[model samples]
Target chain A: MIGRLNHVAIAVPDLEAASAQYRDALGATVGGPQDEPDHGVTVVFIELPNTKIELLYPLGEASPIQGFLDKNPSGGIHHVCYEVEDILVARDHLIETGARVLGGGEPKIGAHGKPVLFLHPKDFNGCLIELEQV
Target chain B: MIGRLNHVAIAVPDLEAASAQYRDALGATVGGPQDEPDHGVTVVFIELPNTKIELLYPLGEASPIQGFLDKNPSGGIHHVCYEVEDILVARDHLIETGARVLGGGEPKIGAHGKPVLFLHPKDFNGCLIELEQV
Candidate 1:
């Protein structure tokens, strides 16, 4: 089952501008950008009191977010992550309930070095959901 | 300054189905729907440990989310709300930094009964941001 709301990922066309907007305009503590080759994105974490806002930018040629950026040129909220106690259990329960998991239904080590799986957006009211083991 | 991420609002085409999905598939504690006429949406809150996921549906004829739902028929993330110590101070600072506030630059009573203001999505990496005085 989902526990805590992990982070909301926003795919931005310009990572630096987005980071600056959060840090200066919003007056929030934002971390430096870190390239996530495995995830095919560069991420900057905006630390809030209760959760994080992840600014994502396409990293490589096959960056998954590139398509998202193509569709949303100015970028948009890409996904919302929820922390789960036991990911396998959560996946199985979700499967039994007819929810489809993405990427062949296998958990991959996420950007945070935690096991994570993405659920199909269609099954989740058009919201891409990432379940991270915590 | 932005303090806590109060909630992430997801505009859904079908409110009941979306609520059921969160309640049954995601195993989240979903609250009953409350029609916020002034905000022009009916909302169902999914209480997470640290924050909340608000499921929004069009309430009346002039529902703001109706346009969003029209563009994204399956529904999608509408906005992200962040708590602020003082909304007016935050507004003035944001304005000084060239960020545009929506709704004629005045704080309106949000669905949570708190003073809230929406920022222009164009200036916010294409994400609608809501600032709530908490």
Candidate 2:
């Protein structure tokens, strides 16, 4: 099952402006940006008291966020990540329950360097749920 | 500043079906449904170790979720809630930082029986954020 809410990801058309908003406006501690080639997103982490916010920008034209932005135009909440003790265990259980795991059902290295799997939105009531091994 | 992530709200087409998916499929501990008339939504809470998942369904046609469902049809993530120590202090700070507080800048009694206010998505990188006084 899901553990702590690891981070909530927001896809932004402009990452710098988004980061500035969190830093200057919200007075949040904004972390440096890192490119997640596997996920095709350049991400900035906003450190909060109990959780983190991920600002995602399309790394390339083929980035998944690019498509989301194309449809949404203004960018928006892209996904929510939940931590799990063991992602493989969670994946197996979710698969048995008929949840479609995105990306061939294999765990990929997420922003935190943890193995992560994404559950299909349709299976999770329209929200893309990310399960990351803690 | 936020204290902790209280819950992530997901707007669902059917509350029962969504609850079943978490309870039966995900093996999560699901709570009873509650009608939040003021919010115009019926909600079910999914308890987790570090946070909760709130499943929201339109209580009436006038429900704000009704508009989201009409566009998404299948349902999806609605908003992310973060707990704050003092809501009024946080609200003033956010306002000074140029964040638009939704609903005329007044905190309403939310589902948890706590004061909650929503910030506009445009001000927060297109992610609708809810701050609750814990």
Candidate 3:
């Protein structure tokens, strides 16, 4: 079961501008960009009191977020992550309830170095959901 | 300045089905639908430990989310609401930094009965941002 709202990932066409917007324009504590080669994206963390907003930009040609940026030229909210206590149990329960997990239904070590699985957007009201074990 | 991420609003085409998905499949604490005629949406609150996910559905004829649902029939992330200490001060600062506030630049009572303002998506990495005085 989902516990806490982990972070909301926004795929931005320009990572620097998005980071600046959150840091300067929005007055939030933002971290430096870190390239996540495994995830195929560059991420900047905007730390909030209760949660985080991750600014994501495509890292390489085969980046998964590249397609999302292509569809949303300016950028958009890519996915919402929820923290789960036990990922395997969560995945099994979700699977039993007819929810499709992406990446061959296996939990991969996520950008945060935690076991994470992505759920199909269609099964989640068109909102891409990432379940991270915490 | 942005403080806490108050909630993430997801506009869904089918309110009941979406609520069920969160309640049954995701196993989150879900609240019943409440229609906000002024906001032109019916919202169901999914209470997370740190924040909330607001499931929005078109309420009346002039529902703002109708256009969003039209574009994304399955539903999608509509906006992200950030809590502000002072709505007016936040508005003035954002304006000084060249961010355009929607709805004629005036803070209106949001669905939560707090003063709120929406920022233009074009200036916000294509993500609609709502600032609420909390």
Which has the greatest DockQ? 3
Residue B101 of model 2 has an lDDT of: 99
Model 2, residue A67: C-alpha shift (Å):
0.5
Interface C-alpha root-mean-square deviation of candidate 3: 0.6
lDDT of 3 by residue, B15-133 (tens): 99999989999999999999999989999999999999999999999999999999999999999999999999999999999999998999999999999999999999899999999
Compared with the true structure, what per-residue lDDT tens digits does model 1 show for residues A48-118? 99999999999999999999999989899999999999999999999999999999999999999999999
Q: What is the lDDT of residue B21 in candidate 2?
A: 89
TM-score of chain A of each: 0.99, 0.94, 0.98
RMSD to truth, every model: 0.7, 1.8, 0.7
True C-alpha contacts between chains kept, each model in order: 0.90, 0.67, 0.92
Cα deviation of B6, candidate 3, in Å? 0.2
Give the higher-DockQ candidate: 1 or 2: 1
lDDT of 3 at A110: 98
Extract clashing residue pairs from model 2.
none
Give per-residue CA lDDT, model 2, range B47-97, as digits (tens): 887778899999966898898899989898889888888999999998988
Candidate 2's residue-wise lDDT over A61-118, tens digit each? 6898888898877778899888888888899988888889999999988778889999
Instruction: Give model 2's TM-score versus the native structure.
Output: 0.92
Per-residue error for A107 in candidate 3, Å, reads 0.5
